[model samples]
Target chain A: SVFNVPFTEKSSPGSTPALSDSSLQSDDEEFESVDALEIYDLISSISDPEHPLTLGQLAVVNLEDIQLDDSGNPNEIAEVIIKITPTITHCSLATLIGLGIRVRLERCLPPRYRIIIKVKEKTHQSENQVNKQLNDKERVSAACENDQLLKVISQMLSSCK
Target chain B: MSLSLVHTFTGHTDKCWATSIHSKLPLLATVSGDRTCRVYNLETKRLIVVLDDDSHSKTLSSVEWKPTGEFPSLAIGSFDSTISIWGNEEAVLEDEDNWTLMAIIEGHENEIKGVSWSHDGVYLASCSRDKSIWIWEADDNNEEFECVFVVQEHSQDVKHVTWHQHENVLASSSYDDTVKLFKQDDYDEDDWVNVADLTGHEGTVWSSDFEKKGERVTRLSSSSDDGTIRIWKILHAADDQPSIDSKLPSTIKTDTNQDMWELETILPIIHHGPIYSVAWGENGYIASVGSDGRIVVYKELNSKEWQIIISQPHSHGVYEINNIKWHGDRLITAGDDGLVKLWELAL
Candidate 1:
């Protein structure tokens, strides 16, 4: 069961987290570096897997929780780490929600970005387990290949800008 | 040991997922996100034909060749939740449209990850993200497949399904971080039951394969996301005197009977990331591919230890290899680079 509790009122998808479309740039053009705010926009509009609300509206994905390290190093691997908080500690849909956010970022970000998603510390009852399951690359890839789970994730991403 | 690139089969515009080598012929079939299965002849080192259809709307995940056919028959699993069986019974000599769809098996609620045919090609087993493994009974006519059993034992999404090379045992790896083996129950013989649960891997088990035929009992090789390869050996009471081997842990036992399978050894870790596929070649070698874009081959030093004979980094360039197969003495690999490569191993 989903606990059915709304944490906050709805938020708009038009936050200032969006960056330009990188595909249009030619080889000579400089690459636009990604920031935490832009990463937030990619997932803020994602619909919650449990409730009929955007993650932004529910305050599940805050801009402060998103961390990006795309500093100007051509050889260095960039990183994006996001921490999400469940409405309740015992929520059963925590892992599914985490997976949804990871999928959205994977589709939008460049391959150079290493994504690390986890439940906020001390929020979930089984915080360590949830964090471990969310960040495992093998399990993440296999979960994305699942048909039923993909459908649910697609629904969550449909509202994204 | 040394390795040399022997052949490269190219044409896929998108990532290729898996490849299947013909049992009797020198033909290789590869499935790709381009929605086509390309068959390449090893002798000519060229693609023979591309089997594509407008009916397929999603990427094909896995492919397998039926063992006994004079003309090759392929079983392809797709992301669109359908398994299409294609046969070349009436194929001409190098025609573009040589293969035709024979049957479409649909029942899984979601995408099919892996598919396998029994050693004799009598049974077809498929695992899906829906967390179910369905066993279908197939015949030689390339028609009507009946679903015999469906079981949901894995707690999470299933990754790969494989059959024993010499027996009827079916093994599946999953996102649940464990490998479960299934076999027909003796009381019914028609119903499939979970016989054993291999519980030691701390992360997801990506792929598993059986040694062609062991000296005493069949051994299984399982590769995992934890970046390690484990070998499982079946400890039969009849094979060893005094009920069991003194070295094996007494806790090993399948759910049904005294047939216990224990983790025999963990191969040397050469992969820094998740291992996607593992294939036990008939040449007494075990080959593995992983996310780090490395292909490592291992040989048994004894039952308790294995040595890395060949560790070739960047076998598929910068792309992760999805599947690996052994064609006699050579190795075939499909990768995210939209290429299928053949390599010769120097033993």
Candidate 2:
């Protein structure tokens, strides 16, 4: 565990990027598309594991680090990639932070969305290792099945807007 | 091939984790998040006993039946970071507490993910989130269990471990995106070594099962987060061809088994999400379940080919099936819906 860092939720999601892209939907794009800002909005409110501050307020999660790829096809595989920069370079809790984001999206999003959480490069001491564990479906699911881990994750999401 | 719903046993208050069938009895044992291991009679399709212990503070993640025992014995793994060996030690097996907690094995620092008894029943292997697999040597009485060997070869958390039907080989799937095989050395009998790492999966390997009745050229069916089921085969070192062991080993074993398991083929992809479990039926079919809420069965067309003969969506009524096992011709599945279903395959 590292020193607790305090940061609270954004009053509203990053509406600038999503609102500026006022492009109209295509004929086949009937389903509401989930964009980067929306994905960020979904997880940005998650509070830090040791602090009261939300990931958005702590600047651990940024809109630019979110990416979504949807072909607008219902049956196709839709992917959501999120990269979070740790406040400290050698943060040991990076994996837990990433897992919190992954669990949040997995619970809120549809089954088609393949969520991938990674530590932003150069921000974490072991970025690749944390990324591997966070993205593993079996590990992620097993962690969610864990009562203690789930309690912490739920606490992180308790203050979400 | 088709699976007709033969029977459904619904009693667990929460999601079911894993189920195991007794080799010598008409019984099925399933563990669930409710922190209980339930045993049901397959012949009568009735709830026989609900085994519960006060020591289990969390979900029971896995249940396994010892292949041979005087009385029925079960190895139950849990998220409480302990593996409890349960059995009826009384001379007369007649009481409300049909099962008694024999021993609580605790060594892993994290939750135990899977527990499996070897084909011979002398060895019980358990994999855990601590990234280590522990093999405990037990007796026929099930009263004593000694942690004999520990293999820490997997780079990440180990999900599941299963033994070969009649061999000493043990295959373990892991969150490290690989399946590793371990065996006791032919020369160094006390030492358990990682025989091979079957890599090629781009995502986490969830579970792997060894094909039953295949003695010489053994086969392994592995399910993974990559949404692919792969078949791996290996002959005895004496029978394997010269082309084996072609994949270079990063850490060479100075003295180990010379045999090597090579990738045979990948099953036709059917499920839309991560496959959580795979089982090679004693009836010679490969059955699989996954997070997609689908049950797919495959038949061997030949040595090099496999065909999807049965594909059923929403088998558990909107819940993901976590574990599936084959009992002779019948298929048994445990789902997140807290239901254990028995299906008859109409070939």
Best by lDDT: 2
For each predicted model, how many residue pairs clash, with residues at least 3 apart or on different chains? 1, 0
What's the lDDT for residue B168 in model 2? 83
Which tens-of-lDDT digit does each residue in B1-347 have in candidate 2? Answer: 57799988878766788999999878789998778888887888877778885768777899999997778788999887899998866534334366778888889988889999988899999999899999999978777788888898988889999988788888999988899888787677657877677889977888999888756437888999889999988754522434534453635433334467789999999887679999998788999998777889999999989999999887875466889998888888988667898998887
DockQ of 2: 0.07
Pairs in clash, predicted candidate 2? none
lDDT of 1 at B218: 75
In model 2, state the lDDT of residue B206.
87
- Chain B alone: TM-score in each candidate? 0.92, 0.92
DockQ of each: 0.08, 0.07
lDDT of 2 by residue, A1-161 (tens): 21010001111111221232233212113234577887888889999998778999999999999988887665455778888999899988888889888776755554446677888888888877887778665456557666677778778878776
Q: Count backbone clashes in candidate 1.
A: 1
- lDDT of candidate 2 vs native? 0.79
Clashing pairs in 1: A17-A38
